[model samples]
Target: MADTQRTSERINFVHQDEIWKAHVKVEKDSAEVWPRKWGFLTEAYKEFERDSVKLKEVKVTPSHHLATRPLTPPEKYTNVGPSPPVPQTTQALIGWRSAHSRLQLEQHGQVHHGRRSFLKVLGWPRDACS
Candidate 1:
């Protein structure tokens, strides 16, 4: 009769195409530092709780607060479909087209040194800057 006790440990491997692997293993000790470590963490946590309570008790006026509340446009401008396409958007479109042309020219060993673009907005001269 042969002994059937297996001496080898089972192979533990991650099943994934990823490269990074990590794990932690701590040996048990009769007198462990874990208690002391936990005590220190608990003391720090209590201190943080006290500080948080102090923070909650603090009352600062909005004017004294460091963070500025962003200024959003009034409710009417929130929905954009009502307005027609503005001149700024048209200029932006033209700019994108010119940039594409420039890229193509550069690829073909050509240099474009002229001004990026010129936007001429044709509108009736305002009598008093409308």
Candidate 2:
């Protein structure tokens, strides 16, 4: 349908643009901006696609094993030792999810959870989100 068409179009656009980059014919000023503004999306889309396939083989349900567990505050956690820092890409993904959820709540009166919100932002075909 329309969603599939849009996804294909985006893939085609990225492929063609990459070809242009390889040819060294890119407009440098704009080229520098393009990847910074949207590079995570392309990478995220690929990841989402890979995760979707793997998810299909497992039971889909929320786990509450630790929902009632006592939590360590950040101050306590940090005092223990230096933990590995979150990568820039992970930070960006967190920001996107938070912002998207907020926007949906404000505009649509409902929030789309992780997978649907992610696919919606990427304009990918959303088979299901629940």
- Winning model by TM-score: 1
Model 1 over residues 2-109: C-alpha lDDT tens digits? 223543644334532132322222234423767766668888899999999999999977674777878887775654333334346665766453354433435567
At residue 84, candidate 1 shows an lDDT of 32
Alpha-carbon lDDT, every model? 0.55, 0.68
Q: For this target, which candidate reaches the highest lDDT against the unseen true structure?
A: 2
Q: What RMSD does model 1 have? A: 20.9
Worst 10 contiguous positions by lDDT, candidate 2 = 96-105
lDDT tens per residue, model 2, 18-117: 8888677556766888999989999999999999999898886667973576787889655443334454786565645345443333654656676547
For every model in order, what is the number of clashing pairs?
0, 0
Every candidate's CA RMSD: 20.9, 32.6
Please, what is the TM-score per model? Answer: 0.27, 0.22
How far out, in Å, is residue 51 in model 2? Answer: 1.2
Model 1 earns a TM-score of 0.27
